[model samples]
Target chain A: MNFPTKVYINEVVLRDGLQLEKKLINVEEKEHLFKRLKSAGVQSFEFGSFVHPVRVPQMANSGELYSKIQQAAGDADLIALVPNLKGAERAAQLSVKNINYVFSVSETHNLQNVQKTTLESLEELHEISDLCIENKISLDVSLATSFGCPFEGEIPTDRIVSIVHQVTELNINTLTLADTTGMANPKRVFQLISLVRSEFPKQKLGLHFHNTRDMGLSNILAGMNAGVSHFDTALGGLGGCPFAPGATGNVCTEDVVHMLHSMDIQTNVDLKELLKASHLLEEIVGHQTPSYLLKAGPYDKKYPVPVST
Target chain B: MNFPTKVYINEVVLRDGLQLEKKLINVEEKEHLFKRLKSAGVQSFEFGSFVHPVRVPQMANSGELYSKIQQAAGDADLIALVPNLKGAERAAQLSVKNINYVFSVSETHNLQNVQKTTLESLEELHEISDLCIENKISLDVSLATSFGCPFEGEIPTDRIVSIVHQVTELNINTLTLADTTGMANPKRVFQLISLVRSEFPKQKLGLHFHNTRDMGLSNILAGMNAGVSHFDTALGGLGGCPFAPGATGNVCTEDVVHMLHSMDIQTNVDLKELLKASHLLEEIVGHQTPSYLLKAGPYDKKYPVPVST
Candidate 1:
């Protein structure tokens, strides 16, 4: 039942959450949301991704959005997702301070997501790593499908360990293990995180989870128990699994903050302000997000007592 | 990260899940659902309540439904909820083998719900205890708002401890601490359950949680860590807090079973068959439920790989 006194949240709504969205949000709107989150005490963000416009039109304005919000970010860490060397080049050109290079450990997902084999993606990660160093940008590597693969199922722990070993060899700021399709359980997360921590004691680690099977928060708890504090979450739970059409998205930022704060595990984020951002996100997305806090409110919220019969 | 190897589920969908629904399902439909759940290896059920028909019109046919399904239930535990002496009399006249007596720990909620104060409810519990023993029926007591109340806010730990001490003095078969408004966090759940366990070492205890803040599964995990094994869940995540509209309901049965099985903690319930029952429940309720497994499937389900581009 032991837990960390505090945890770090890296907001990913602008990148991972909005990537699969149908309506492409303009740069102004993205900046507006960014400023709102900044006011809500979000110190780190995966603001956007530098992928091709044709492939993911929703994130086509990454550079424009960054330019608009960078000044307002103050001391906040603004990170961009870079899928390959070209994405790295785009991020470097935009003077993005941090970049997260992501690849799937599962072969089929790697091919489907990036049109490259696992080996090819690792090669690209090397190039992306070198590019980030040359451009004076902090680099973070995320091993997607580290938990399990939607198409392949049950990824071997050895595969993730080997990938982590290879990725840690580079000059990276953090290594994140992602449950790309929300296939991880608490036991798997605890075991994998414990193994990786023991193997790479000096390496900084992060976790990204999805609530697709309603195990997202539980997995995060397990990861925290395993000594990993950094986590990726989306505002209002505004992301969806492209492969699993009706499934839910990432671990919700507001919901996670609410739960953490309730448990006395500080995230330094204001739940009320974060919920306001989540409400605004619902408007931006033109739909209700899968946020428990948004619907149920916080645990301490008091309702007026009804008249006695 | 340690968990119970096998946990018992007390299905409460028939009573709790449907009590709030506006549409009234017939006895035949209830029988159908009961048979479906039984086939899925569910051996215990809070099948229906014996409240006044005018108060809970949805459960008006509890006696008829119970009679229809009792023969088919075989050795399965078909328990009925009784909120007062009249309800207990109704259950006794129907020859019900087991009955659950529930009252709110919060005086405001108890007065608002049952037109009685907490002390008056305890007085009635003594009477009901006598009634159950005379009728040769097992009795279980559920203390609602054990975590926090929507109107009263945080219920004192001392209050709950005192209530548990009083209730365990009766001839109750089991005692359940219910998070009536879904306000229990993992830390609170762990501390409260641990305290209760130490106070009543020989008492058979259970937990009932709501997913209002998305901490239902995590709280269950914490409760398990504190040595409690029995839980109450609803199919398809049915049920809601009458005090908090639009909030999610109880911890979903199939989702809980899925996570437990994934963690190698057995529930002895077939997840796939349980899903089939959930689907039937969705059709019966005429709306999509808040079930994660219903939307995302299980972690082990392998989707066919799309044709390579």
Candidate 2:
């Protein structure tokens, strides 16, 4: 039942979130969001992906967005998603400090998502790792579909551990085990996180989750109890699985921060300012985002007295 | 990390769910809902409340609805909510097997909600307990706002323990600690349930949670890990506090069941049949309810492969 007092939340709204959104936010709007998130005390931002514009047109302005936001980001860490060596090279050219490379453990998902087999993706990751090292950038590899696969059923722990072994061998000490389709439960989350923690005692791990099945926050709690402190969250709970239709967005950053602060856990992100950012995102998205804090205020907010009998 | 192999979910849609809804469902409609829920393998149901019709017009026809559905209930345990001696007497007339009485541990919430101070409610509960014992009806007392109060802030653990002590002294060992405003986090849920379990070793404890803050399922997971086997859930995630504005509904029965089955935990409930019931409830409610399963199909349901480059 142990939980970390302080947690590091990396905002992924620009990359993992808006990547699958219907509306395409321009570079100017992206600059606005980056600023808002920074003002909300987000020290880490995954601003964009270096994937092909034709594949994910929403992130086509990654190069321009990086140039515009990096100066404004100041001391905050700005990371970019890189699928392979080419993406890594593009990100390094922007002088990004952190480059994230993701590959699914599920073979079928790896093929369907990045058009590469699991081993082939690993090979590309090795090359991407070298590229990041040469550019003096830290490479963070995320094992997508590490919990369960949409095409395949439950993934074995051995498969996940083996992949982690390979990734760590490439000197990528920071890893994210993603619930790509939100098929993870509390038990599985605790089990997987504990397993990874024991195997790689010194490795820094983050849990990336989706609220597709409404177990996002529950899984996060499990991860926290298992002593994993880094969580990947989205503002206003934006983002959907390009593979799993009807799957909701990532876990809401404001909601998660509000919950953490309520339990006396320090997240460093200001809840009120985060809500303001969520409100702006809601307006920009032109629809209601799945933020519990935005809809229902903090637990301490008072309601009118009940009409008694 | 231990989860019960078998969990008991007491469906409260008819009683808690429909009570705060805007539309008034007819007796015949209630009969349909009860049958649908029974077919979903719900072993227990809180179908009606014996409160004064003037106060809660939604449950005015509890007597008629009980009479109509009691015969058809068969093996399922049928329960009704009773606010006072008169409500308990009315419920006894219908030969109800289980009668639940709820009073908030928070003095302010109890007074604001039921128009009675905590001591006054306990006094009434003693009389109601005597009536239930004489009528051979099982008495289950739920301590509402056991975690936090809408009017007041967090309730002290000692206050909840004192209330539980009062209820158990009446020989009503079945107790429900309800999160009236969905303010209970995982840590608080584990701590409170653990405290209560240690104090009342032989008592049967149930958790009633709301999705207001999106921690409903997380709280349930925490309760389960703390060795609680009984939970109160609503169909279509219906049910909100009549006292607390902007408070969302209870945890969706289908979503909870779906998550349990995903983790290989058995609840003996048919997931498909439950979704069917949820769909029917949605049609009856004439709007989209807060059910995740109804919107996003179960975890095992797969999506078409993404057309990747």
Candidate 3:
């Protein structure tokens, strides 16, 4: 029953959340969402990713969106997702304060996502790490498919540990283990996180989970039990992996915040304000997002007593 | 991280799942679903409730449906929910082998649901217990709103503990603590289940949770951690409380089984067969269900890797 009193939430609606979205949101719309989330006490965000425009047209305007919202971030950590050294250079050119260098631990996924092998991606991470150092920008590394690979079933824990070992060697601010295809169960999350925690006790760790299997919240609980506090969540549970089509995206932000707040674990996020942003997200997406809080409201909401016959 | 190696799922879709639906499936259709679930290794079921036919018309054919499917059950526990002594009497006349008597821990909710006080409902449980003994039928008790109430925000732990104390005195086979409004978080679930387990060391206990707040699976996990192995789940996550409209109902049977299986906890239920039944349920209900497995498939399902450019 023991848990951390405070948990940090890294909002990723604008980046990972919108990357697979069909409607390409303009920079102004992305800024509006950013301001709304910032006001709702989201102190960290992944606003957009610096990927090739033609490949991921949805994130093509990362630079424009960053420029428009950078001043309003105000002490908050605004991170951009960078696939490699070129994306890192693009983010640095825009003076982005923080960037998350993500690569898959699964070689097949890595090749499919960025046309690079795991070793090649690690080499690119080195280059991206050096670029961040030169630009005085904070860098975080996310190992996608850390839990399991779609093409290759169960990933060996040693592989993730080795990747973490290599990734932590650089001057990275945080290391995130991403369940890229939502294949992680709670037990696996607990076992992997416990191993990683013991292996790299001093490393600042975060977890990114997808709700495709409806194990998202449970996996997050397991992550918390294993001593990780930071989680990446999307507003209204938007975005799906291009590889895992028809599956859900990240663990939802408002749902996670509501659960944490209910358990007295402070996330410093306002549920009402977050719901407002979630509703706005639904409107922007032109479809309903798979957010439980948006559909059922909060747990404390009381219904009117029915008049007895 | 410790959990039970074996978990028992009590499928309640026939009773709780279809109760809230506008469509009243015929007895034959219900029998088809019942047989399908039975073939999928589901040995326990809450087939239907015995309420005023006009009041809950959805379960009006409980007796006929029970008769149609009872012979095929073949040692499987086919249980019916009874609201009071009259419902118990009706079930006994049908020669029902097992009956579950349910009353809310929250007096206001009890009054609204059954036009009786909590104390009055306990009085009826005594009568139902006597009838069950006379009919040679096993009896179980479910305390609805044991977690939290929609009318009353939080039901005191002492109130629930006292209710459990009074109910366990009868010859009840098992006692279930129900989150009628889906208000139980994992921490609260762990704390309450721990208290109940300590107080009634020999009592066989169960948990009934709703996915309304999306904490159903996590609460079940916490309950398992506290030594309760039996759980009530519905196929396709059907059924909503009449009192709490717009809120989702019981946790999906497939989702819970999927998670438990992923953790290597044996449920003896075939997930693929259960999914086939879930798809049939979707067709029966004439709409898509809120089942994660139906939407996302299982974690081991692999997609064809895109041919790299």
Best by TM-score: 3
Per-residue alpha-carbon lDDT of candidate 3 for residues B191-298, written as tens digits (9 for 90 to 100): 999999999998999999999978898999889888899999999999866755444679999999999999999998999999999999988989999899998889
Which runs of model 3 end up more than 4 angstroms from their true locations? A244-247
What is model 3's C-alpha RMSD?
1.1
Q: Per-candidate TM vs. native?
A: 0.97, 0.97, 0.99
Q: What's the lDDT for residue A198 in model 3?
A: 96
lDDT of 2: 0.87
Compute the lDDT of residue B144 as modeled in candidate 2: 86
What are the per-model DockQ values?
Answer: 0.74, 0.70, 0.78
Q: What's the best-to-worst order under lDDT? A: 3, 1, 2
TM-score for candidate 2, please give it: 0.97
Pairwise lDDT winner, candidates 1 and 3: 3
Minimal lDDT window, size 10, model 3 chain B: B240-249
DockQ of 3: 0.78
Q: Candidate 3's residue-wise lDDT over A208-243, tens digit each?
A: 999988999999999998999999999998876665
> Model 1: share of native contacts present?
0.88
Tens digits of lDDT, candidate 1, B70-174: 899999999999989999999999999999999989998887777899999999999999999899999999998899888888899899898888999997998
| Ten residues in sequence with the least summed lDDT for candidate 2 chain B | B300-309
For model 1, state the Cα shift of residue B225 in Å: 1.3
For all candidates, what are the clash counts?
Answer: 0, 0, 0
Q: How far out, in Å, is residue B74 in model 1? A: 0.7
For candidate 2, give the docking quality class from DockQ: medium
